[model samples]
Target chain A: EAEVAQSPRYKITEKSQAVAFWCDPISGHATLYWYRQILGQGPELLVQFQDESVVDDSQLPKDRFSAERLKGVDSTLKIQPAELGDSAMYLCASSFGRGTEAFFGQGTRLTVV
Target chain B: ELKVEQNPLFLSMQEGKNYTIYCNYSTTSDRLYWYRQDPGKSLESLFVLLSNGAVKQEGRLMASLDTKARLSTLHITAAVHDLSATYFCANWVGSNYKLTFGKGTLLTVNP
Candidate 1:
């Protein structure tokens, strides 16, 4: 089975610093997603991409968070000037198409000190 | 906005028991998914219900969806300690591929 890949399994940084997470989806997948998960809550969607184009970014904090899937394959999520509230597990998922089944990456655990 | 909510945010049960977790959505949807997550880990897909009256089961867990009622249920049969984890139900609403996740049901099975 093809698995979604994510980089920097763990990250620790001071508040107001910059941090970036990378994800490589399963081959042939055309839809990608980014989610933020707090300790005890469900993951919330931060962004969604279809063939390198963003379909939803309503939940993303545009002021500090940015994401791009240039080739509609590998994608990246960056957070500049990270705040304490930004400390959470950032997860990446992808599917062959919208409303299709998706596979999730292990995630990048971010700690903002 | 589509809202997903699960009942009994937390649950504790003994091994060999049975329990069901409810997932309710405020709006209509195309499909529903059940995922399991361990502490500090990524989500593991468990089940996906595609249409009304759809039911799928794996191991001791069974999930059913009712699109008309806008609800889904995950039932555990003879739960085991290994089943202890947080389970979330997410739904696909409208044109977005984004899934709205329920708060999750934390199941703790004591041996």
Candidate 2:
């Protein structure tokens, strides 16, 4: 089945270390989303990308978190100085159109010590 | 702020029982989605309700949306042990395609 792809299913790093997560959306999907899900809480939108251009990033912490989608297909979310609170499942989803059903990736589980 | 809420937080059910999960949103929306997640796994799309009074069913789960009321329901009939998972409802906000997820309903079906 066609699915969104995410890398580094699990990662463990020291606090203040740099961490990055990668996602490859399904073919022909134009919208990509990044969400942070903490334990026992719903997923929160951190960023939204329409193709390679960022549509929204208000919820993302600009000082530490950054995301980019190059060539309008693959995306990368980076954290220059990861913090203890940054430990959560980073979920990536893609959809063909706005207000459409989004397909989610397996997500990258990051743990900062 | 647009928000989605699910009731009961957690549910314990016996196999072959019928139950319904409720989802209520805080704002106006025309689209809603239901997703299921197993322990330590990604989300699995269950249903998408795009209009008022939209109803869809698959397997043992039937989902209905009442857009006018800003509510949605996921009903399970004769649920089995394998149906144990976390269910989330996402409400589409405005035109940005951003979805606000509910706290999720954790269902545990005991045999």
Candidate 3:
């Protein structure tokens, strides 16, 4: 079965350093999502992409976070000057379209010291 | 803003027992989803409830949705050690197709 692919299963960075995570959604998927999940909480949407355009980023911390889906196939999420609180599981998911089931990737676990 | 809430944040049940996890959303939505996650792992999609009164089942799990009540449920039958995991229910916010998830219910099935 085709699944969303994420790179660097784990990442550890110093506080204030820059870090990035990558995600490649399943083929033919038109919607992509990046979510941040704390250790004991549910995942929270950080940004959403439809094709190559951003649809909603209301919960994204723009001051230090950025994401892009340049070709509408794969995406990258970056955090500049990462903080301790930024340590979390960054999950990428994709779906065929609205109201469809979104499949999640294995996820990248980030820990900032 | 849309909010999702799950009750019984932690549950400990014996094998062969049955239980249900309830999810309540703050707003109206036609789509609800149930996902499972093991410790130190990513989420696994369980069920997608697309309409009011929609119910789906697989293996030992069953999920139902009530769009009018803004509620969804994940029912586990004949619990087993393999069924132990954190289950989350998410509401699909229509305008942007964003999913708002609940805190999750951590279930531990003891054999």
Candidate 4:
């Protein structure tokens, strides 16, 4: 079955350093999402993209976080000057369309030291 | 803002037993989803409840949704070791299609 693909399964970075994560959604999927899961909490939406355009990013901290889906196929999430609290699992998911079931990727675990 | 709440944050049940996980959301939504996650792993989609009174089942798991009540449930039957995992309930906010998830219930099935 086709699945969302994420790169850098694990990342460890020093506080204040820059780090980036990549995600490639399943083919033909028009909606993509990036979520952050804390150690013992649920995943929270960081950003949502629809065909290369950002639909919502209310929860994203613009001061240090940025995400983009350049070609509407794959996406990249970056953190500049990462903070200690930024340690979490970054998950990428995709769906064929809005309000459809989303399939999640393996996710990238980031640990800020 | 939409908020999702789940009860019984941790559960320990014996094999062959049955139990249910409850999810309540703060706002009205027609779409609810259930997902499972193993330790140190990503999420696996379980069920999608699209309408009020919609119920779906697979294997030993059944999920139901009540859009009016803003509630969803995940029922596990004949629990087994393989069924042990963290389950989450997510609500889809309409306009942006953003999902707001609950804290999750960590279930441990003892054999």
Candidate 5:
């Protein structure tokens, strides 16, 4: 089975530093999503992309966080001047289209000191 | 806005015991999904409930959905140590691909 791939399974950085995470969705998937999971909470949607265009980013912290999928295939999420509270697991998921089941990646765990 | 809620945020049981995790949503949705996550790992899809009375089962875990009631359930039977993990239920916001998730239910099946 094809799976979504993520890089830097774990990242540790000092507060005020910049960090980025990468994700490659399964081939042919047109919908990609980025989610953040806190230690004791369920994942929350941060952004959604359709093809190479952003569909929704209402929950994303625009001031510090940014995500992009330039070619509608792979995506990158960056946090500038990371804060301690920004530590969490960043998960990537993809599906063939909207309103369908999505496959999740192993996720990148970020920690800010 | 859509909201999802799961009850019994934490559960502890011994081998052979049975328990159920409940998921309730605030609005009508197109589908409901259940996922399991082990510590320090990613999510594993457990079930996808798409219709009013959809139900699916795999091994010792069974999930049921009732769209009329806007509820879904994950039932574990004869649990084992391998079942120790956090389970999450998420609902697809109408028409959109976005999902609203409930606070996960952490299950600890003690041997």
Candidate 6:
């Protein structure tokens, strides 16, 4: 059972600090997604990557957030000057290809104080 | 712009009872997905409904999709305490694979 892997299961930082989350999709998966899940809401797509190229990032807050999948296998999401409202569960998911069933990682929970 | 809506945001039912969770989408999409999440856990893939009249079942859970109606349903049969979780339905956005998810239905099966 190949699963997406995420690092820093839990993170706590002060507001205005920088934070980063990492994700490694299942091998051979070409589509990767980053999402943010609020406490009681559905996950919101932040970015999508296909073979190291960004396909969609319309919902991503580019002013403070950035993501990169340089090798198209693993990805990194960084947030500069994190804000209290930025606290949420950062989820990573991947699929064999676009429009396929996606597998999600355990997620990285970020908390800003 | 795509939107997914789920009904009965909170449901509490007795163990061994049956219930259905409905998902309605604002646009037409050939692919729809169902996922389950326990508290503090990641999403667990439940079913992938592709095309109209597609149905899939596992254990006591079953899911169906109707592309024309822009609707999907997840039915739980003879549910148990362990079946309690938050269920979400998601579909592709526009011509891409970016998913738009429903707010989710929180089910609590009381024994």
The reply for model 2, stretches above 4 Å from the true place, is: none
Could you give candidate 4's per-residue lDDT for residues B60-94 as a string of tens digits? 99999988888899999999999999999998775
Question: Per-candidate TM vs. native?
Answer: 0.98, 0.97, 0.96, 0.96, 0.97, 0.97
| CAPRI tier of model 2 | high
lDDT of each: 0.94, 0.92, 0.93, 0.93, 0.93, 0.94
Q: Let me know the DockQ for model 2.
A: 0.85
DockQ-based class of model 3:
high
lDDT of 2 by residue, B41-109 (tens): 888999999899999999999999998888999999999999999999998875676778999999999
lDDT of 1 at A82: 98
The sequence of per-residue lDDT tens digits that candidate 5 reaches over residues B1-111 is 578999999999999999999999987775899999999999999999888899999999999999888989999999999999999998888556587789999999998
lDDT of 6 at A21: 97
RMSD in Å for model 5: 1.0
Predictions in order: chain A TM-score: 0.99, 0.98, 0.99, 0.99, 0.99, 0.99
Residue-level lDDT tens digits of model 2 in A9-92: 999999999999999999999999999998877898999999899988989999999999989999999998999999999999
How well does model 3 score by local distance difference test?
A: 0.93
Q: Which stretches of candidate 6 lie over 4 Å from their true place?
A: none
- Candidates in order, interface RMSD in Å: 0.8, 0.9, 0.7, 0.7, 0.9, 0.7
Proportion of native contacts kept per candidate: 0.94, 0.86, 0.97, 0.97, 0.89, 0.94
Which lDDT tens digits does candidate 6 get at residues B1-111?
A: 569999989999999999999999987678899999999999999999988999999999999999988989999999999999999999987777788899999999999
Docking quality class, candidate 4: high
| Residue A101, candidate 3: alpha-carbon lDDT | 88
How close to the true structure is residue A83 of candidate 6, measured as C-alpha lDDT?
99
**Best-fitting candidate, measured by lDDT?**
6
- In candidate 1, the residue pairs with backbone N, CA or C atoms under 3 Å apart (3 or more residues apart, or in different chains) clash, namely none
Give the per-residue lDDT of model 3 (tens digit) for B1-111: 568999989999999999999999987778888999999999998888878999999999999998888888888999999999999998877688787889999999998
